[model samples]
Structures are given as structure tokens and as C-alpha cells.
Target: MDIVSHLNDRLLFAVPKKGRLYQQCVDLLKGADIKFNRSNRLDIALCTNLPIALVFLPAADIPRFVGEGRVSLGITGQDQVAEAGISVDEVCNLGFGSCKLQVEVPDQGQFTDPRQLIGKSIVTSFTNLATDYFRKLEAEETNGVGADEQTQSSKPLKTTIKYVGGSVEASCALGIADAVVDLVESGETMRAAGLKAIATIFETSAVLIASQHPTHKDLLELIVNRIKGVIAAGKYVLCNYNCPRSKLDSVLKITPGRRAPTISPLEEDDWVAVSSMVEKKRIAEVMDQLRNKGAEDILVFSISNCRV
Candidate 1:
């Protein structure tokens, strides 16, 4: 089904077509078992496993589709949502594509403080956020510098914000902008471009956003819960092992789950089987501790999806 056909019947889900957040959103849907097949060059695809239609759009436009109620849900970066400046409900964070919106200056420039570039030009794709940041800073500076003749010399230090579609870092080198407000994932890109960040405006990550006027509430909640389950499973694992009853207390300390772990008597009188959920990152360390405490047959298994 296409976007035009799904306006009233099916839920339209907008995802990034190509960008840092594109593959992440694709993987999230795949992990949730929401399979989709599409014809070549088609912008819309119907999910084979769910009552959802996927619309491949530019990352910057996903928030607009959601806010305008053209789509039921969307997955895009928080920076995109902030730039769109729309009234949409943020359902959840998808936990990938994390980066910081930062203010960067040329390497040789002696910019030390955000206030130092008050009257300078800043270029960014996130024009809304950049404009708001400077407007607030200007207000604070104006209020703090009140009733002082010398300070009044710098009375209205407004930043000139210019919006660019891409290659924002080049604006500084090209002499079009004195500084830039852009996203920095590793800072390697900025450094290679001969720039350095002076101040971080905000951090952003991939987020699940929904239209404030959702047409399908039940399906929307189901999809959100399924995605949440997949995210939870990715971060945790089920750990099971046998430990002597005498060492249960020590082992429990290592794998104490959301609630107390399950402890059941084994065939042997003094041995017990323990099961618990452990964070994926800490599974190795927890197993080591369990082994040190005389646990045996320790197993770590992946969870496909989980509610808790």
C-alpha cells in the first residue's frame, strides 16, 4: 500500500530513507518482526507481518509527517524533531544514533566561550534550535548587563543564524559563517574539517514519535510495546546456573534481577537452580562472580523480546 491509500485504514509509519538513522530504524522494525517487502523505487511498502505501511522519507521530513497527522508514527533523530518545532508526542527513545548538537569554531579561532561569538554568524540545519539558543542567551546577557554604561555598549548581542541543507562544517572554511551549530557524533568529522567544538547545545538520539492526533490508538500502543520489548531484549539477557544452597546469597548479589531472582531446589539436596535477567554488558562479569562463588553450568542466552 502507498501513502495515499493508508490515510484512513492502515497506520502510516515514516522512516528515514538514507542517513545515520536509516539503518537503525530498519533494524528496529526487523527486530520487532515487522517484515516489509517493497518494489524497486517505491517510496511506500506494506509490512507483511503487521498492519503498517512504511513510508521512506528524508530524515528531516519525518517529524513533519508525524506532526501534520499524515503519518501515525515516525522514527527520526531528536535534532530533526526539534528543528521541525512541531507538536508531536515523543513515544520513546530508540537508543541509537546518539550525537550532540554543538557550536564549533575553526581550529585557529580563539573562541573560548559561547558568549564570545554573540554577534557572529552561525550556520546549521537545526535553525530553530540554534535561533532559540541564541535568543535565550541574548536575553540573559541583556538582563545581567543592565544599568551599566560600559556593558550597555554590548546591549543587544544577537547571533545571526543561517540555515543550510548540508555541508554545514564547510561554511566556516568557506568564509560564509564564522561558526557552526551542528551534530557531532565522534568529533572526528569536525576535527578533520579543521573545527573544534566550543559549546554543546544539546544531545540527540533516535526517537519514536507519534502524531498527537493518532487515528489508531490500539495498533499504535501495540507497535510501541513491541518496539520497547525488542529494545529491552537487546540490552538484557537471561542467565541461568546451578549454585550450592550455601553460596546462594553470594551468587544472588551478582544477578539480583529487577525483582529477586528465581531460586528453586535442584535434584540434589544442597544445590539449587537460579534464573535471572542480567544486563548484556555485565553478563560476563556476573558469570565470573557466580563461578567464583561455586556456581556451575552457567548459561547466558539471548531474548528475542521481553515485556520487562
Candidate 2:
């Protein structure tokens, strides 16, 4: 165990403090019924029943923390992790904060492929990713000189990077840059700025990152299990209904669930109260199907946490 980690048995966890990803992390925890009861102004969160110290940091800094082992765990986007070249292993894909990192250009431009960019300059905030992409695209199957000679070879593919504060979509229209490498969520901003994506560089989502360093194995396992439970619970809903013996088979077929449905006798001898979990978004559809098969007193409730 590292001296630092050994000194602090409490796991250090980092989360994004602002932006879309931060809200998602909070919503996921709230949906799991995990309360954060720290001072309103404080950036640190303490899990009610866990020994973990949560620090809210800038989203872009999360990878650095996880990679350096300053924090034992982190919740941030996959793009940031890759960009930072972090080696932390992913523990979970939270399934939110979905977006695409792409190379986009002005709608009027006819440049569709990398070959056309051989002599052109590309502007982007993701300097590393952009440089890597263009380097490979400019490179060819043949040897450096042979390929460069055989290719257009008119001018070297020059990539100049410029970091704008925000709103990269407008860069193309304003003539501040040729093309932009940025996150495209709904393409609203892109369309508004008369920009169209020419190439998708990467698809990103929120991921849970865990440190590779040694630590309290038991505590780490407990924390992991609890977090997983919270995630599973958010994806499922508890549903219960009464059905006659004749319709039990039909009801079971509709609510087969992740494992098996719990069936118990009701006060009425001919009926049974069967309970199971249905996917959260599909609860209504499943309930309707069960109702059509003679299910009565149908009830749906959110599951707070689950462990398997």
C-alpha cells in the first residue's frame, strides 16, 4: 500500500462540480436514495453509510486526480479520461452524459475527408486528439517520403490549435477558425451556427474510475457493491399485482423479471400476489400486459437500492 493511501483509509472520490455531468451524478445518487448532507457551501460530500470522502472538482481535472491516485475513485466523462491518458480502470458506465466529440466544419465547405486537409489547418481545443488524428490521416501506407511524394504532397498538413473559452460552434461562422473539435450533444448549437459534423472522433459517456493502487480491500469492495446497488435500483422498478391461478402462467410470462417473480397466496384462495421488478421505463407497458392477462391491484414503486 502506498504511504498516502495507507495513512487515509477513507477512500477519496472525485466528481465534477459544474456542467451537465455534475447534475447527472447528483441525479443518479438522489435516485439511489443516497443523501449528501454536507454544508451547502462545502464542496465535499460524505456518504451517509460509507467511509468515503467525496470532492467535487472541475470535470476536466477528474482524470488527472484518478490517474495520480489523489482520489481513489472518480465520476467523469470517458473523453476526459482518454485525453488525460489516465490508466485508472473503469468501474461502471453510468449511462448518462451521452455526447459525441467530432470534427465539424462550416456547412458550405466541401471538405468531407482527411485527404482534403493535407495542406489545410484545423483548429480545435482538443489539441492532442486533433494532432493525433491529423498525424495519422496525413501519414500514409507507404514510407514517409514515398507516401508524401505519391500523395498531393503540395503542402504539409499543418494543424494549428487555438483554445477558445467556449461556444466553439460559432468559431467557423465568425471566421475565427476553419473547423472545430468539440462536443455535440443535440446538434442544436451546430445547426444554429450553420455547422455540420464531418467526422465523429469519439462517443463519450459518464464512467466511474477506480484507482489501481492498493487500499483497504474490504472497504473498497463494500463501496463498490453499494454503488453498484444504487445503479441497479435506478434501472428497475418494483411491480406487484394479484392474478387468479388460471392466469398465473400468463402473468409470469409477462413479468419474468431479472431472476424470478415472487408469487404468494392472497386472502382469496384463487388469487396470488405476484411481485417482480420491471425495467423502470417499461413498467407501464409491462403492467398493461399483466392487466390484460387478469392482473388486478397492480402497483409500481421505485427501488431505492439493489445488490446482486
Candidate 3:
């Protein structure tokens, strides 16, 4: 059987084959307990424990596959989905691979604003987004003008947006383009290339997306919940402690969990034990606050996986 025939009964999940999000996606799958062994030089992987097949493709292509229903699910950057202009359901934010799509100019150039380079050439992989941004900018400039004047002012944007698969930053240095629109994570790479950001287009992060109509809707929900569990596990920890009855109200305020903290009476008079989930980043501060509130035996435990 060919690949399509093999996947006929399995839900197709598109993942980035190789890019900034590839490894993080793989780790997420592992954390969700989706067992699979990808063969050497093959783009497809069959899950051993589920009726799901992983289709390895470029991050830019995953959104198209999911949006078209060719793949039931996908993990990709929100910017890719926007650039594709595809209709799909955003399942949840995975909270990694965060970056911003920015309009940048040469650091030492006279152009300091995106509007300054409006009529200049821009090179970027996100051609559609770049074109739309510049078009909107031009429209904004003609906002208060008369209809005829606006029409005259909005002649085809003098700004030319050319698509370059890579090396977008080098376009300015090579004199082929006056500015570039690209993804910036730390701003280090752009600085190294002598480019500075003038305007931010949008912020994006890795997102789990699903087809508008999934063939295996039930299975897709199961997988989505599992992925959410993995994300929650990474973000929070279980906090346990004992507090006096008089301090219960004050202590609960410090560790207000997803819901209410679980409270159980202790054998000793006027004492209660509390268990709650706290953000991993704020655990130390929460512990200190609990201690100050007359709580004792405060302990933090890592969560491997959970439904909430």
C-alpha cells in the first residue's frame, strides 16, 4: 500500500520535519506518550500506541495541510498560519518557539520607520503578510483624504515585496532591497547582520491547530487533551503544606490554584493540610508567602502529566 492508503484509517498529524520547532514538537509528542520510531530518511512515522501517523513537513507547509483537512492536526508557528491565510481551528498555544515578525532596516540607514521605507523594496519569505502590511500602511496614510484623492494616492504600492526563501537580512547589505521583514527571536541575529527593527508586525508562538473538520474527531480530542496535559505539567507544580485554621484563609490566597485548593483536616486541633497547583516560576515566592502566613512543611512536587 502507498502512504495515502496506509494512512487512510489513521489520523494524520503534521509536524515540522526540521526547523526551529522540530525538536520541541518531538519532545511534546514524547511527553504526551505518543510512541513512535521514525525510520532513517523517511518523512512519515507510525505511532505504536495510537491510530495516528506523523507526517514530517516544513513548518510553513503544516498549516496548509491542516487547514485543507489533508492532515487532522498540526503544530506550527502562528505566523505560518497567518502567512498561509488558511482557515483552521487553533487548538491551543504550546508556549514555545515564541518570536515576532518585524519590519527591519539597515542599522545605519536613514530609514528609521517602516513608513520611511514604504516605497522601497522589501525581501521576505512571508510575501503575503508583507504585501498586506504595506498595503494597509498606504491606506492609512490616505485615511482622511477625499475619495478621489485617496484613489489617486493609493496607486499600486510603490513598495515592492519580493519573496526570498532565506537570507532575507542580507538583501539590504547586497543592495537588492531597502528593508526586510523577518522573524526575530532574540534580535541577536538581526544585530549581527547590521539590521534594526523599526516596526513589529505581530508576535507569534508555536500553536496546536486542527482541521476544521476532522475525520477522527474523538481521537483528536483525546490527543489535544494529552498535549494540554503535557504543557500544564511543564508550567506548574503540586504544592503541599499544613496551616493553622486561623491562617487558612490567608494561606489560600498565596496559592490560589486552578480552582480552589484541596483542604483536609489534620489530626491536631485547628490545623489543616492543603494541596494545590502553583506556577513553577512562582513556587519559591509562594512558599515564602505561605511560610510568612504561619504555614509549615511546605513542599513542591513536579507534575509529570495531568488533565488540568
Name the best candidate (by lDDT): 3
CA lDDT, every model vs. true structure:
0.87, 0.77, 0.91
Q: State the lDDT of candidate 1 residue by residue for 62-178, as single tens digits.
A: 999999966989999988898898989999898899999999999898887888888889999998888777766676666763345445434443788999999899999899999
Best by TM-score: 3
Residue pairs in collision within model 2: none
Of the two candidates 1 and 3, the one with more favorable TM-score, higher being better, is 3
lDDT of 3 by residue, 151-230 (tens): 64447877899998987889999988999999999999899999999999989999999999887899999999999999
Candidate 3 residue-pair clash tally: 0
Which stretches of model 3 miss by more than 4 angstroms? 1-3, 144-155
Model 1: number of backbone collisions: 0
Q: Superposing all C-alpha atoms, what RMSD in Å does each candidate have to the true structure?
A: 3.7, 5.3, 2.4
lDDT tens digits by residue: candidate 2, 1-308:
12234326567778899888978787766654556565676677676656666788988888888788658778899988887786988988887888998988888898776556555556665666776566656666334533554353454446665676578777877777778888999999888888888888889999988888735567667667777788778789999999899899888999998899899998998989999989888988898898888999999988877895
Ordered from best to worst lDDT, the candidate numbers read: 3, 1, 2
Show the lowest summed lDDT stretch of 10 residues, model 3.
Answer: 144-153
Clashing residue pairs in all predictions, respectively, total 0, 0, 0
